[model samples]
Target: MSKEKLFKVAFMNQGKVYELHAREVNQSGLFGFIEIGDFVFDESSGIVIDPSEERLRSEFEGVLSTFVPVHSIIRIDEVKKRGNNKISDLPEGANVTQFPSPIYTPGKGKND
Candidate 1:
């Protein structure tokens, strides 16, 4: 039987780290973005409930796809199986920096 591919994507969002699984991960057609589709959540944990994971699920509920900034992405991995999706707080003194926007101003016209 042919198996479908799965990927785990980790990215920074609003001062937290979001890690989730999807069937598709690729460079977005939109500039400076990564496209993710077919989000996969744990269906085996019927008796167990994780609030953080639930929050992540609801946040992306009904969304067909999402674009994340390239700089915000920490890593993407093709995995043999799915893992629990979760959000995490950055460790103390963590050295990750957010991507700076507005690298250029198009219409300032030399500032007079």
Candidate 2:
């Protein structure tokens, strides 16, 4: 937990998806629960946790022994990379032109 080091931690237990960026994850009050792994997915925020809680808990169970808190989960499912778009996905037809070209006629008078 050095100041020069950045923690890649993830929390998953309950039903809340949250992410935090800090030099030391342990020092950032993100402790208490053990890291599951080096890979956790935050569906709500659409962020893939670099360090998963499942993996961390198994690997470092003996070194820094702890349990995942049942109340600190940030997400239930891993958010898709595409994300939820608000615009419609319908097909485009010839009648649907995003922009119309300006008409120009030869010798067209301004008054005309």
**How much is 52 displaced in model 2, in angstroms?**
20
Question: Which residue runs of candidate 2 sit more than 4 Å off their true CA positions?
Answer: 1-3, 27-112
lDDT of 1 at 39: 98
Evaluated at residue 61, the lDDT of candidate 2 is: 44
Counted clashes in each candidate structure? 0, 17
lDDT to native, each model: 0.91, 0.35
Per-residue alpha-carbon lDDT of model 1 for 1-112, expressed as tens digits?
9899999999999999999999999889988899999999977668779998899999999998999998889999999999889999999999887967853457757774
The 10 consecutive residues of candidate 1 with the worst lDDT sum are 103-112
TM-score of each: 0.85, 0.21
